[model samples]
Target: MQKSDYFIKGILESDEKVVAKIYNLFFPKVLSFVYRNNGQREDAEDVFQKALLQISARIKLRKLEVINTSFEAYLFTACKNLWRRELNKKQKRVTNDEVKELVSEESDMAYALLDQERWELFRDKLEQLSDNCKEVLNLFLKKVSYDQIVKKLGYTSETVARQRVFKCKAKLIEMIKADKRFRNLK
Candidate 1:
């Protein structure tokens, strides 16, 4: 078994020792990250717990054959994403209590996980594109001007650059839509 699979199995089986080891091994880094990112100790604790729960829930809900990345890396990313979502919600809070809308924390976390999965799918699909297409798409995402793309890519004209961007984008969309996971995410 892969080294990471041990942890996945342990978590799935609720092995206490393995769980403790995970907390000892990863909690400090998560704590430090949250502290640096405008969160308190409590926030870090919450994020860490939620990340583990999300990972476990995902594994239970699907086969989760392989992590692709190391388990540590995957857990850290989930924590970072959850923390960022928390920060965003804070920023969007309504000052007036009466005007505040009710939102379920469970639903929010579920949505965050789904969004992360969709992003991962998109990224994998993007990596599968041709080098030229990847470069063009990256530049387009960064909002670079068509003239700049033309100059950088040695295209003859802005029109040519625009056409290339549109085609590449369409291909990317097609690839993303073709993935089965895309439907579940929606």
Candidate 2:
């Protein structure tokens, strides 16, 4: 089996030594990323734990497939995604004076899992596009100005950039919508 599969199996089998190795080998990178991304040490720790749990849950549910990247990359991405979700939640949180709704951990995990699925689906479809389409769509999605996109992509004019962005976005959406997973994601 591949090294990544060994880690996955360790996770699946609840091997303490393997888990410890993962934490030792990977957690420092996660900590660094979280620290750079408006997160504290505790936040990093929380996100790391949650990411592990998320992976565990996905494996148990048979939702995890191939780790197209390294296990380290996958874990780091999972942690990054969880951290981003946490940041968004924080931004959208009401003040202490306002009425607060209690959300359970399980519910939060469920939402995160579903959100991850949607993101993966979108990412996979995005990979199917031409390189030009990927670049145009990425810049467009980032809200880059048409002029900037035109300059960056060496387009003749903003209108051409706009057209390319529109076409690329439409193609991406069509591809995503054509996926069987799209229905469940929605």
Candidate 3:
């Protein structure tokens, strides 16, 4: 098996030694990311812990499978995403001056994290949709044109593909709105 597979197995099994190694290997990078994004050391620690918990939960649900990315990249992305959500929450209460300061110093990482959070939420809600809806929405998200979607999904016409995409998008919005976690995140 690959080294990343070992990391995945260790995380799934809660192997102390492997977990410790992962923390030692990846925590610095996560910590640095949080620190650079207006977070303190304690905040970085919290983010790291939360990322680990998310990974554990996904593993338990059989939702985390190592595909294109390494385990390290996955863990780091989780940390960035959690930190970005925290930053969004913090931004709501900050004054205009504070907001300006943050914006002035904003890194590409911050923007990427924001986009990542959005995509993650969309994917989470997409899973709640019907198989047909999932297919249509996924294609739409991938920037497939209406005519292409019609051909690919065997829809009657471009108009049908457009309608399916619109309906699926509406359903996804409804699912997101109904989620308690979505409210909490906002």
The lDDT leader among the candidates is 1
lDDT of 3 by residue, 118-142 (tens): 5567667888789999988878888
Q: What ranges in model 1 sit over 4 Å off? A: 94-99, 135-167
Rate residue 25 of model 3 by lDDT: 98
lDDT of 3 at 32: 91
Best by TM-score: 2
By descending lDDT, how would the candidates be arranged? 1, 2, 3
- By TM-score: ranked, best first: 2, 1, 3
Deviating ranges (above 4 Å) for candidate 2: 94-96, 142-145
Residues 122-180, candidate 2, lDDT per residue (tens digit)?
A: 88899999999999988988999999998899999999998998899899999999999
Prediction 2 TM-score vs. true: 0.89
lDDT of 1 by residue, 1-186 (tens): 886999899899999999999999999999999999999999999999898888898889867778777899889988998999898888767444555675798898788788668767888899999999999999999999999999999999999999999999999999999999888888
Report, for every candidate in turn, its global Cα lDDT versus the true structure.
Answer: 0.89, 0.88, 0.77
Task: Pick out the ten consecutive residues of candidate 2 with the lowest summed lDDT.
Answer: 91-100
- Report the C-alpha displacement of residue 92, candidate 1, in angstroms: 1.6
17 Cα displacement, candidate 1 (Å): 2.2
